[model samples]
Every structure is written in structure tokens, then in C-alpha cells.
Target: MSDPYGPPPSDPQEPQGTPYGNQPYGQQPSGQQPYGTQPYNQQPYGQQPPGQPPYQQPYGGSGPSNPDERTWGGAAHWSALIGAFVALAFLGPLLVMLVKGNQSAYVRAQAVESLNFQLSILIYGIVSFVLAFVLIGFLLLPIVGLIWLVFTIIGSVKASNGELYRYPLTIRMVS
Candidate 1:
């Protein structure tokens, strides 16, 4: 059978070349400089290369992460309330801290703060529950719950707004 590609070019000295834009080595048509020979002072077209770390970029990255990252951190702070109502106040924040803590400092800080607060509330709740057997226990349990709810809401708001939030009553058990 005949080759569908019509055999190859037969000219021994005609110089093989790409049908695409490339014009082969040492034979660039008229004006263009060869690759990598850009003028010494010319900067690349977009995005400066990574080296010496720009004095201006903060947070040890090319630049601060986008706002969406901050939102995720904030959400982590708020999610602790879900655990609170479910009787596992540390689950949400603990999971977030374990899963995403290393990704961004802001997220890690929020997660840690939430976890600490939840743990403190857990301790307080246990104490209040045991004390409920006594005359004063009933009042303290409800008050603790109210305080937890209010503080969690405040922390969530501050985090969502990209502000640092430290739980006022947190005891730093997890640090």
C-alpha cells in the first residue's frame, strides 16, 4: 500500500522545517532576536519571578491570599457553634484545625481560638451539670450556655470580617 503521508521530502539540501511558526535554528527571518537574548533591562511581561522575596509581600507568600481564604478561616471560627448545640463543642473547630490549620496562619489562629473556647465551655458545662444536683446548679448551667452562645457569635463576626478574635473566656487548653 502507498504511504498516506506521500513519502518524505526528497531534497537533500532543502532544510526540513515546521509548518508552524518556528523557522528552525540559525535561520530566524530578518528581525527577531533568538530565544533568551532579551535586552538586559527588559522585565518579563507579567509577574516578577520569585527570588529575594519582594520586601513588600507579607505573610511569607507571593502576596496575601485572596479574601476567599480569609472567609474560610472565619467560617471555621463560626462552625464551633454547630458543635455546641450538638453537645460536642470541640468537634467542628478541632476538625478544621487538624485539616486546614497548616494552610494559613489566620485560619490556624481562628481554629485554635475556637477550639480553646469550646474546650473551656465543655469544662464549664460539665461543672455546671454536676452542680445542677445542688440548688444553684440550674442557674449556672443556663448562664454558661448563654455566654457560650453569645461569645461564639461575636468571635464568628470578628473572624468573618477578617479581624483577629480571641475568645474572652477561653482558657487556652489546646493553645
Candidate 2:
């Protein structure tokens, strides 16, 4: 009786000596290199081939090359609406700027514009709140709010259309 746990007996009709039957497990059949070794002319990992240029990220300073980039630029302007409800309107444009700013100059510029506008609005709102005690703020506050809404909507539309829109009353604090 054969041992149950041992290797199975070789077949009589099969020609086998090495572990791979025709060649040893670690050896290549002929002039080929070993499994993990690279040939003499092969490039190292992550490097460009002989005549090819290295990979580079696209720069969009002149203009966005694709619709997705335009969308991101537009988002930088419209995101202010989300933060406005919480009285932290700068947070939305600031967030978009930090996340996508490095990848595209168009997005960075739009975010900066939105951030400046929000900051200007904040300052106006604060002054209006203080003036409310004198009864003047009660009127100025609503006007400021209305201006903010209209300008933000216009900026968003312009950005979505692939044009840069500068808010008329925005202080250029952010650049």
C-alpha cells in the first residue's frame, strides 16, 4: 500500500525529472532572464521609456481645457450659497480653493474672487448690524443682503458660462 500523505507516483508514459517536468522550477528555458529580473536595456519602474517625455499635469492658467474643469471653476463661485445659510459664507469658497486650487489656476482665481466677495459682505453686514441700534442698520442690512444674493447669482451664472465675473461691490482684499 502507498503512503496516503506522500507525493503521488509518477506516470510511466510521462517523461519527468525536474520539478517542472521539462526544466527545473528556478531555471528559464533558454536565453530569458529570471522571473523578477529586468533585461539590460529595460527602464526602471515609473520612468519614461527611451524616447518618450516624462508625464506632466496639465496647467489651465490660460483657460480650462475641458468641461469638468469649467464645472469646478463654477463650483468655486456657487459654493458660497451653502455657507451663506450658516453665516459662514467664506467657508464654501475657501474649501473649494484648498481642495482644487493647486490643480487649476482657473479654479483658484474663481475661489479667490468668491472669497473676497464673501468677506466684503461680512464686513458690510457687521457694520449694518451695529447701525441697527441707530435704526439705519435696519434698512442697510436688508439692502446688503439683497445685493449679496443678486451678485452671487450673477457670478455663478457667469462662471458656469466659462466667463470670470467680478462682483461689483467686492473689496479686492483676497486678490
Candidate 3:
């Protein structure tokens, strides 16, 4: 009796061949080049391969490279609206700047611009409130709110388009 663990017996009707079928070890099939040789159309490292288009670096490696970055940039400006609802006009931009600023320069610049503008608005609002004792603060407060809305909208639109926006009258305190 044959051993259970032993190899199966070869069929007598089959023709004898190498262990790897008809081809021997280290040999390629017919019409194919041997191993260790580069293909005829292969290009060197860091080069565009034959028949392939060259790769384009996104935003020249400086600006926002993808849609997410652009979204974040726009968010940095739009976030101030949320903060404004809570009477903390700088909080939204400040949070966005702190979280995403280091990842992209575009977002950082937008956030900084929004944060500075919000801060300036905060100061204006405070002065307006104090001056309300003289009755003029009431007028100044509405004007400050109008200015904040207009500039924040402009900044958001520009940033959404992947453009860096600088708010007019920003104090640039954070830089």
C-alpha cells in the first residue's frame, strides 16, 4: 500500500516534463524577455513612463491642494457667523484657525483674517455699547453689525473660491 503522506503517483500516459510544467526554472515563456532586464518602454525613476501623462502637483504645493482644504478655508471665514450668534464673534474663527491653521497656509491666512476682523468688530461693539449712555452707541452698534455681516460674507465667498481674502479694516493683531 502507498503511504498516505507520500506524493501521488504520476500517470504513465502523461509525458515527462519539468517540475514547473514544460518550462524549466528561471526561464520565461516564449516571446517574453528574461528576468532582471528592464522593459523596452520603461522609464527611469522620477520620470513619466512612456505613453503616460506627466503628474501635476496640486496648487504648486503651496495653496490648497484639494477640495477639503478649500472648504476649510471658507469655513474659517463662515465660522464667525456662528460665534456672532453667541456674542463671541471671534470664537468661531479662532477655533478654526487653531485646528486647521497648521495644515494649510490658505486656511491659516483666511482664519487669521476672519479672526482679526471679528476681534475688531468686538471692540467696536463694546465701544458702541458704552456709548449707548450718550444715545449714539445705539446707532453705532447697528453699523458695526452691518459691517461685520458684509465683510464676513465677502471673505467666505473669496475663500470658497480658493482665493486668499484680507478683511478691510482688520487690525492684524494675531498676524
Candidate 4:
């Protein structure tokens, strides 16, 4: 039977020539330039074509966004603390990295994290050796102090390249 809304339902073979007939959602119409073709109004589902103008979209004529402005600040930051003048100066950088590492919000945050971890190990080693020496002063185990020093040196070398090492009985006083 037929109804009076308009023409009867067409056959499944009918062609849909509407702009959106063949185009997918959130896509621009084919055969049209991405930019300078349409007004700045709402684009077809707000889609931008490749190699367009104005470089508004990310990864375009102007390039992608820079997170930290590409600085070796991470290394410099840790270096200020680790590379020091006196023998105990190394602890300054190590401790600084560990305490302030979590606050790093840069592209090299991962590097800072690793540096901090390694620094912690170095500091622990130094402290352990010092403790061993103090014990030896009381006529106790002096060899343990020597062993701690050796291990600490190795750890410092490894840490220089950014590694993670947790020392036993260490205190994390800061974030």
C-alpha cells in the first residue's frame, strides 16, 4: 500500500547525491581544498585537510608544540648539585635531584627521575661509608667502610648515565 507523506520509499539502488552521502563523519567533502575554500565558519564536522594554510592545527606549517622549549635544563639542573668542588659536593647534586625530581615537568622528566634515583644511591653509599668509619673509630668493622666506598664509586659511575638504584635504610625526607 502507498502513503501520502511524499513519494513512496525509493529502491535500495537509489543514489544519495547529498554532500554527506559518501563522506564519513568528522571529515571534509572530497575534491575540495582544505583551506581558503570555505569561510571560517563551522567546517564539515570541523575537519582540516592535509597541507592546509594558517598552520593552526598541530604538526603543520608552523610545526608541533614544544613542551620544554628543547633545553638541556634537566642535565644542568642535576649537574649543579652533583658536580661540586669539594669531596662532599657530589652529594649536593644527588640529593637535589632526588628531592626535586618529582617537581620536574619537562620533556626530560624521565631523565630527571632516573638521575634522582641514581643520586639517591650515591648519597646512601657515602653515608654508609661514613657510618662504617665511625664504627671503626670505636674499634669495629673498618673493612665494611672500605667495601661501602668501593660500591659507592661504582654506583656513582652508573648513576652518571642515569640509572635507578635504591639504597637500604635510606630516608626519603622530601618529594
Candidate 5:
């Protein structure tokens, strides 16, 4: 404990190279240090230091980010065919999408398109059946029914594959 390292450090608690010189007497670095030991303008422990704000995640690294991306897929472009199938059995689903699903415009548009497709098929089948009965009676019933069936199946398949098809002579219900 002689002065081999130039005046031996004034405080035993502080390690070497503390720009603030020797730490306070009896006070250990773990317990306390001389006032000069702290950096200039530094605040006390458990307090916000000078200049810097508390650490926080960078602007766009992680954590819950965009609401749109989470709620709806990008563009929200899913198969409207699902809606069409649901509407065929129960019109309630289409109505639900029209009202609540409008939270995403893309979903709303697709739902409306699906309802329109189903309505078109129903109308075409009705009109064709009536005309066939009036003109050719029972003879054309099977032929007209077969044609309608073929077209409906084809349309459904196409829609399921994300293709938009317009059926002829169908009333427009949605813009």
C-alpha cells in the first residue's frame, strides 16, 4: 500500500482511469463515488439522465405495427367465390359482409360482387325456365335446365379461381 503508482489513489474504492480522479473515501464504486466521478451534467441514479430519452424500440423494427396489415391481408383479395357459395345456401353471410365487412373496402366489394353473381344466376334460371315452358312446353324444359346447370357450374368454378364473369341478361343489383 505504498505510493508505487504515484500517490497511490486518494480513494481505495475507485479503479484506475476514473477521469473524475480518486473516488470518495470509504465509499466503494458499488456503494457510492465522489461527486467528480460522474460524467458532467449526469443525473442521479433512477432518474432520467441528461440529453437522452429512455430506450424504446426503433420506429419500424418490431411489435404490433399496421392495423390494416393485421386485420386484412394485403389488398384483402381473397376468393369471392367463398361468399358466393355461402350466399347460395344462406343470404345472411353476404349481408353480414356488406355491413360489417366494409371495415375493409376490398372485402366489401368482393362480397357485393359475390351476391350479384348468385342473383344473376337465379334470375337467368327463372326467366329461361318461364320462356321455355311458354314456347316449347315440356320439350325444352330438360334442354334449358341442362344449359342452366352447365353455366352455373362453370361460373362457380371460374369465380372460385378468382375470375370475374358477367352472365348475360342478369339484373344489376350492385354497382
Candidate 6:
């Protein structure tokens, strides 16, 4: 192609903006730092910018950022409630228990309790369904449901407080 702006510059010291690009490069205004760099030695936003030593260090030193710390332990315990209402039975607690059990003692215990209770409720529900043919199932079903509801709420509250709670009727099938 013919040179639209004549031949390339002869000087080696010329500032070619965006070396490989066709855009013309220009000098930055005085007192301004280049993109990707901060004024002087300052770090960019979201970074732990360097600062002069403080006269007094803050109380309660912090540990390295821990992913585990961010996970709420109570949710695992409360998953049974979520599962009961949302999954119509056992999937919620099962999922939370299996996924988060190993990450925290709070999660492990709560999830285990919730899982065990859900399993027990599953069995009770089946038994109640069968008893329904005999008329006793109709009565037992509400009782079973009430027990499940009350205990699940208690478990959720205890778990939220970081307190250990065990469902009285839970069978502990999975330990």
C-alpha cells in the first residue's frame, strides 16, 4: 500500500505509541503516573497498600484469610428445615451434610444431626403412610410431622447459637 502519511520516521528516539498499533503515541502530562502504576510506590485499589509503621499495633492479630471461616456452620444444621419444606423430604440436609460435613465441626455435627433426623422422619413417614390404611396412620402422621417440625426448629436455633443439639428421636443412622 502507498504511504498515506509519507515514509516512517527516521529517528530511533521517536515515541511510537502502542508500538505495534497504528495509533499515534504521545507523552503523558507532567506529574501523572502511567496506567497500571500508582503515584510513587503506592499499591492499586483493593491491594494492602504499604503504610508507615504504626505507633501501636491493632488488638487481636488476624490470621491468614481462611475460606473455611466464611462458611456458615449453622446452615448445615438448618438444611433439614430447608429440605423438608423445599425438597419435600430429604435432599436438602443430604446435600448440605455430604458437601460441608468435613469442613467444620459445627457443620459436621449439625449436618449429621439434621441428616439423621431426616432419615428418621423418612422412615416414620413411610410407617405412617402404611398405618393410614388402618386409620392409625392418619393420626400418627400429624404426630410424626409435629415432632419433626418442633425438633427441626430447636436444632436450627441451637446450631445458630453454636450450641450442639441432638434431635431426641433422631436414629443416628449415618452417625
Cα lDDT listed for each candidate: 0.76, 0.83, 0.83, 0.43, 0.47, 0.66
In the range 17-136, model 4's lDDT, one tens digit per residue, is: 545466776566654556556655546655666577643321112211242312232342344345444534334445444554444433134234334544554565555567666674
User: What lDDT score goes with residue 74 in model 3?
Assistant: 92
Model 2 clash tally, residue pairs: 0
lDDT of 6 by residue, 79-104 (tens): 66776666465666667767865555
Selected candidate, larger TM-score, 2 vs 6: 2
In model 6, the clashing pairs are none
Candidate 2 lDDT by residue in tens digits, 64-169: 6778778987888789988888979899899988998888778888888899999999999999999999999999999999999999989888888888777888
Q: Which whole-number lDDT from 0 to 100 does residue 50 have in model 4?
A: 54
TM-score of 4: 0.27
Please provide TM-scores, in order, for all candidate models, with all chains considered together.
0.61, 0.64, 0.63, 0.27, 0.34, 0.56
Backbone steric clashes in candidate 6, count: 0
Q: Candidate 5: minimum summed lDDT over ten consecutive residues — where?
A: 69-78
Stronger candidate by TM-score (1 vs 2): 2
Q: What is the lDDT of candidate 6?
A: 0.66
Q: Clashing pairs in model 1?
A: none
Q: For residue 110, what is the lDDT in candidate 1?
A: 79
Ranking by TM-score: 2, 3, 1, 6, 5, 4
Candidate 5 lDDT, 1-175, residue by residue in tens: 5767676446777654545446566555544455556666667675676687975322232222344422232112233333345535216325545554546443344445445555665565566677765775356556544654555555445434444434444456975
How does model 2 score by TM-score?
A: 0.64
Query: How would you encode candidate 3's per-residue C-alpha lDDT over 1-175 as one tens digit per residue?
Result: 9999998899997655555456876687666677766688776567886798876432233457789989998999888987778888788888988998877777777788899999988888899999999999999999998999999999999889888777887787997
lDDT of 3 at 54: 74
Candidate 3 lDDT score relative to the true structure: 0.83
lDDT of 5 at 114: 47
User: Relative to the unseen true structure, what is the Cα RMSD of model 2?
Assistant: 14.8
The better-scoring model by TM-score among 3 and 4 is 3
Error of 4 at 31 (Å): 63
Give stretches of model 5 more than 4 Å off.
1-93, 135-170
